[model samples]
Target: MEPLPAAVTAILLDIEGTTTPITFVKDILFPYIQDNVEEYLQKHWHEEECQDDVRQLKLQAEKDSGQKGFVPIPSNTEAELQVIKGVAANVLWQMSLDRKTTALKQLQGHMWRSAYASGKVKGEVYDDVVPALKKWKGAGMKLYIFSSGSVEAQKLLFGYSIEGDLLELFHGHFDTTVGSKVESDSYRRIADKIGCSTENILFLTDIIKEAEAAREAGVHVAIAVRPGNAALTDEEKSEYHLITSFDQLPLQSTH
Candidate 1:
């Protein structure tokens, strides 16, 4: 790979399938929520925070009622078990479809915070990611994260990662709140928010559509070819710069 373009002053990263393995979320995090949602609710059901999560989920459920396979959450007035069951089922249904609703993300973020705090879970990062981030940070590259995961969930992952806290390496975080990753305008908006031209940001992700979107916004794009990431088409492999590890990023200088 050639040296990174001198105009690139910032890095925008995707989490799953980029800096972290896709299986971390697919095999661990989501399943953790699925297996523990009921127990988590039963344990913390009386807490105002938990109740609020349920309230938001209930609202989402109501909104989704007209849609197929929507799980109905019972109001708090119902029997405690039934209410919890309803919320649990609703959450599971949303998860089954991999929904990213703020309601569902809010609940999942809280649950992950607890799981991380108690050492029941630790975030997974590629072995090369931390050192590369340090090098990039030291070289004065402004770094940011853009992921489908809620910002709080993103924080939890890096805050308790295997390599210790990696949050300090980032300049900021963006979630779906900005926009979908596949939208070119989302890249432009992120660049605008970060006070840079879109051309100054290099985005790394495992998905071709996201790369194309970022490229459309005039940002440089590289696809991370990591283990467990979706296989890239041969056409895609020939069309974009690809790296199997962060160290493959061609920095202009160590200074």
Candidate 2:
């Protein structure tokens, strides 16, 4: 791997396939959301937060449906059960498509809180992650996470992590609300938020498009190649520095 820029003062990391295995998200988290959505919605539908999420879901469904325009699911007592069922189906479909809608992420985070609290779910990080994070922090580098998951979800994952409460290590968290990960402007915004020059932040991810976008925005970037991650194309391999482990990161002492 190429040397990280000496000017780098902050490290922005992607969760899935970078610090955490991709299968944990696809196999464990997604399936948990799918299985629990209906029950959660049914139990919480009358609450204000649940209603708000349903409204947002309806809006996204309309956008997804295009010119046809989405029909509102009736919410009256006689029809509310069917409405919940229909909305649950839409949520599942969105999950299947891996849509990064804010409302969907919020709802997922809400569900995950219960799961994590009840001991049904715990976040997983690669063996090297905690030590690497500690080393970077000790060297005075700020750490942040930029993931498609909601900021709340990001905190929950690290807070309930298998490594035990890694949340304190992170300086900040960002999600799609900031912008899509593949957009150059998002990296620029993150750089601004962190009060660092674009050139002084290093972005790490498993996706080639995200690495390209961050690099385009003037942030140094590296592609993580982890087990269970998609194989990189020859072109991608040629384009970005690839690190198979966090221990390979070229973090230098700031002092």
- The numbered model that scores best in lDDT is 1
Clashing pairs for predicted structure model 2, backbone only: none
User: Cα lDDT for residue 181, model 2?
Assistant: 97
User: What's each prediction's TM-score?
Assistant: 0.94, 0.86
Best by TM-score: 1
Candidate 1 Cα errors over 4 Å, as ranges: none
Quote model 2's TM-score: 0.86
lDDT of 2: 0.87
- lDDT digits (tens) for residues 198-225 of candidate 1: 9899999999999999999999999999
RMSD in Å for all candidates: 1.7, 2.8
